[model samples]
Target chain A: MTAMNPKLIALDWGTSSLRGFLMGANGAVLEQRGSPHGITALPEPGTAGFEAAFEALCGEWLDRWPALPVVAGGMVGSSQGWREAPYVRSPADVSRLAAEAMEVPTRRGLSILIAPGVLSHPSGGAPDVMRGEEIQIAGALRLHPQLAERGHFLMPGTHSKWVDVRDGRITGFETYMTGELFAVLCRHSLLGRLMPAEAAAPEVAEAAFTRGVEAARHSRPGDLAHQIFAARTLGLTGEMPAAALRDFLSGLLIGQEVLSALGHSAQADTPLALIGEEGLCRRYAGVLQRFGAVPALQLGNTAPAGLFHFAIAAGRVAAAGEPAR
Target chain B: MTAMNPKLIALDWGTSSLRGFLMGANGAVLEQRGSPHGITALPEPGTAGFEAAFEALCGEWLDRWPALPVVAGGMVGSSQGWREAPYVRSPADVSRLAAEAMEVPTRRGLSILIAPGVLSHPSGGAPDVMRGEEIQIAGALRLHPQLAERGHFLMPGTHSKWVDVRDGRITGFETYMTGELFAVLCRHSLLGRLMPAEAAAPEVAEAAFTRGVEAARHSRPGDLAHQIFAARTLGLTGEMPAAALRDFLSGLLIGQEVLSALGHSAQADTPLALIGEEGLCRRYAGVLQRFGAVPALQLGNTAPAGLFHFAIAAGRVAAAGEPAR
Candidate 1:
């Protein structure tokens, strides 16, 4: 039963970094490796660069199991990646995503399974799309089947997503640019001038953050442009130190995002789940706790779990109890 | 009456540029000069820099009228300017601003009157402020006294302000960082990536802008961080060109500011006025018209007019039909 050898190479690639997961027959991670070579961070350009990064991060594993199936997700499957994988329209399920897993033939006669992204078109709005988070959602659903009955999956990161899953199918979702907004404001706006480059002490930062959350939560609709100025004024008034402004901004943005969610999607007595980085998830959890809609499941690195599910469904790999392909 | 020669020197000094106005005995502007030397853009640093900028901008006018009163308003009275003129609390009027003008003694043997800024403490919120706008309000009140009776004065710029005035006094005001937010996001956020560095066709830009304003106006409260993402999505989806994104963003932010104002301050059939740059004020006017609260009075560069009002009140210059001081 020491067959924990890598049965699949799962790669999660994005704008800034790439993470590879060596998954076993049972969808468990056997080993993990990471690289700074994201789709845009390649040592070289185009397919050659992607190939080099892939080799650098997973060459040894590939050398040991030359025929092992490889699955790549995130922006790596976008128009700018090694090979493009088209997005699966919303209301899609596991079979659709698996059926859409693209193949890129390599010189070694190996086919890399590129995960397709998900796109949703809300009436009278621009189409919303996601590539990596789709995989994460699949993994979350695979990890906890009960979560599929009815729930809102909150994935917090550069571009956060609030996904609606019902009867085990993603019916719809929306993307909130909270993290990117926070970064742009803190790095470029006048508000960033007083904020020092250093991090503040924990308890003080948390308190400041909570204050920001409370402010955003209680503010009126269309008040963000008005209220965010407080981040500067509060510091100028000597009510809070510069060190705590970052967290305060974080809490304010997340609080507003949560407030918007409470208006329709994430609500009282409804199932919710948090997925992404641990600290980010914890922050979302804490903010949601304020709204009294605590996430039912908190998971991390669900991309590999999601890929495993897709691979099995696509027949790229056998079932969990069966022998490895 | 040909003595329209400079009777007073008024300078509206702000962060990026300075405007100097030479006034006659009756408060009519005899001449005007502009300098790129704002508080933060002086040729040198500190008082020396400020003095140099002042000398470069007004040395000729001062030489001709050595006894002329020199009055300055805006950031020139900020803590980092020639001298700090502390803020006058809300419920302030022209007389309060005139009476509190601080004089900075210069090596040139002339007293430079600095306008004090206005501050308001909203219950359970951070204090709000405006240094130059108070001067503009004073000018507006002097220009059209009926305006001060009951009106919401909208001052749109990097930081937009909605002032509640009643019975000839500024009762309260709130600041919105709309222009600043739009600038930061378009220059630094992902939304800016697709935006080209050139201007789009005017008619196309205006339509896009109106679309953005409509979106923001219709969005739910706390929905800005969500709605703004459309700036990127709409471009990616080919519903809009990259050139139109800037205008769209401008409209969205202004729409949000207007939305918040209408929520409490700016309402239908109420007296309203706009004081700021012509283009910005026009944008606000357009957005407000969408809400059926068109500005009643629209004025440009009211700071000098404000200075003239303050100068007469402070006895720096003789009133109309009076002899020169």
Candidate 2:
């Protein structure tokens, strides 16, 4: 993969981890690098931390490919980041993201363009925001143009994003703290106290999770707040094994996310394009399928391509780097 | 308050605190004492711990009135408590609780009767359980007989309970982890990280809380699982003051609890009874009023009344203590 001429170095830096992708001509992966140092995990405070972490992760690539343009996406561009790439409001597209990208110059003489996050204002509801997911959406659209003009994208992660793209521009999106909620509830809530030992055997996890999704599907919109108590009562009543408590909760939370996200949206029937780690995306796919949502696209790890796409729009990457449809 | 001769010792021994009421005839409080050593706050393990904590809280009263019947309610009767007072399944009433009270004798030559919890099984949903609130309900009903035949009770706390009573029985109930959820999110989640410094001022807390409740009310069901993100976004966008974030979150969580618990229940409109801490009860009462619910009763510290009511039904306390409605 390193044989191609490297064109751009892209980074998807989030709260807890940093991943770097060295892209070649036509958006090919020439090489890749990763670090535990996310925006929240800097070795030092301020620019020095970001620069040192950035250099440590892919400084060799930059040293060898002196002229290579570097770009980053995610929370790395937040206010707490090395430099704030203020959020660009929707409706947006890769071009708008490029236009809003904030350039931070480093001591190494290489200026990195940190992609801005997208903020969506829902009528009659509070505003929503996303950082790195927008870049992934850009890459998804670039790789699958059929999805460019119109698509429903679900990126399941610590903070899941259900994005809507209209006419090749990013229209709007909603955020569900599904992954985060699951983590906190398991680690902090009373129901969580019963999960650990019971979750040891993953054998019954599948069934328990499915049951949770089914329960979520059948419940009313406001039901999940109290309905979650089943994670404990069922175990106490000897109706469910303690071992399945963890999985049952995982299912219930994810199920509730899916139920709320899809049930209230008119565009749910549209084919969904999922972008995230395989396991989480699979869970969402199965749950979405439960709601009769047609499986559309599964585009994973589109960060490099997305950064390349954004850089191209920003006129940083040459058009020749764009892969043909 | 201690001038009257004490006739009974009633204790509300819960997870984190223990309150003992020295009662005279007619359920009058001769004196009262409290301790932080709840069923969960034992200095040691096993019966010894409960015995020690129990004695430490009200040993003088027990010694002064050795023949006075001792009665306790709350988690003290759970499997983790002094003894396992098996749950009396719904439809259950104070009589059932009295009938199911588990008695454990102490080395002090005195016997203590621990009140039982209630288990509610909702159709097509998971089972729900409450160890202490049932006693509170019994007390509430004893204090307001008008509600015994049919009433809706909201006991807001770490685990909020929306209980349904009919024909003098606890027919059903739902538990919402509102207080716990607020705690965990504020202490653990990303949104929580932005709360402390900004929440210094209490002046705007009321408005922020009201806004959160309004948002919860306007949101579709299932939306809360994600709608909670506004606690952060609204702050970030400068739409809401940072100080307001904490209360907003509190309001959102409590409001969501109300929305889900009451939205799906047919008995929600019934004149509602609010039981629990005074402040939390006030919050529930205010939110209930917003939903057009008729506020029926605000019975605080009903445990003494509840324990006495249960003791009477159990034939431990004399009928002379029964307060006439």
- Cα RMSD of all models vs. native, in order, equals 1.9, 2.6
Chain A only: TM-score per candidate: 0.95, 0.94
Candidate 1, residue A172: the lDDT equals: 90
Candidates, DockQ: 0.79, 0.73
Output the number of the TM-score-best candidate. Answer: 1
Best by lDDT: 1
Candidate 1 docking category?
A: medium
Point out where model 2 deviates above 4 Å: A1-3, A198-203, A321-325, B1-3, B197-203, B321-325
Worst 10-residue stretch by lDDT in candidate 1 chain A? Answer: A261-270
Please report, in order, the local distance difference test score of every candidate based on alpha carbons. 0.86, 0.84
Candidate 2 displacement at residue A113 in angstroms: 1.6
The C-alpha stretches of model 1 lying farther than 4 A from their native spots are A1-4, A322-325, B321-325
Residue B160, candidate 2: C-alpha displacement in angstroms: 0.9
Per-residue lDDT of model 2, residues A104-161, tens digit only:
9998888999999999997777899999889988898889988877788889987888
Kindly list the per-residue Cα lDDT of model 1 for residues A99-118, writing each as its tens digit: 88888877666878898888
